[model samples]
Target: MNVAAIETVPLFEYLEFEFLLEYDVFAPCDRGRTRVHEPPELFQGFLHCYYEDVYGTRPVTRELQKPLVWFSCGFDRPPSRDAVDRFLTDLEHVVDDVFDHLVE
Candidate 1:
């Protein structure tokens, strides 16, 4: 957990994430040891991008340093732009499902 993110987690600590965890959001993907971001965390990260008007991995990485976004992603530590690219790319096929799931 990042210190900056930890400082402000209480605001969302009570938030329920059970809904997002109900399904294996990444079941369609071939993720193995490289799975870093989970569904709940990705949902939170997507919300951050939606509100922040930041799109794409590079853009998301720029905003990832923000305390709220950092907390949303549940990141253990700030990741590099390349790492973000890889993570998002790995989950790219499910991006549509992610948005659809959100609307339902």
Candidate 2:
């Protein structure tokens, strides 16, 4: 899937898109100063843009342009920083795998 490939593009190539993933404090699920609540499965946040690649004439085009994110936790009750870090790291790997498909 293109989603898996976005990360596969060499780090140099990825510089083309303006990648912006942030922990938004203003989303509905974001608690002001308390614990961040779990977003419903279908909740659409900034993260939704990433999957647009799945539905495109050229999925690779969408994957390269779209930004990926995980916006659930907040400063008050943030998810483990390491967990988020690892998720993104894994995502990068998946992107690489997906990229491999593109070349072949």
Candidate 3:
């Protein structure tokens, strides 16, 4: 199986920010190896980009296809100052947890 693309559809887009997720299954499989092609610009125009622009750096991505699972998340804007702080604080934890769970 092969995934051409994964679309993050916005479930809610308010003035504060946008919340999105993979609404459609881009790849389906009965059995066999599944391959997912990376998008051209994974973080373009997203809050992750914005954070990198403002904060000076983004998370270091570690690719692990051991079990062949891929996951990603992004934010467009924050509703409050606290939200911004929280995101910065929690980003590492989120990445670590994802890596730990997926690579295990």
**Candidate 3 on 11-88: residue-level lDDT in tens?**
112222211112122223347533232111222223333433434223212121111113323322212333333333
TM-score of each: 0.55, 0.22, 0.25
lDDT ranking of the models: 1, 2, 3
The candidate 2 region of ten consecutive residues with least summed lDDT is: 37-46
| Count of backbone clashes, every candidate in sequence | 0, 6, 0
Candidate numbers, best TM-score first, in rank order: 1, 3, 2
Model 1 C-alpha RMSD to native: 4.9
Instruction: Evaluate model 3: give its TM-score.
Output: 0.25
Worst lDDT run of 10 residues, candidate 3, spans 60-69
TM-score of 2: 0.22
Off by over 4 Å in 1: 1-32
The lDDT per prediction is 0.60, 0.31, 0.29
User: Which candidate has the highest lDDT of all?
Assistant: 1
- Residue clash pairs of candidate 1: none
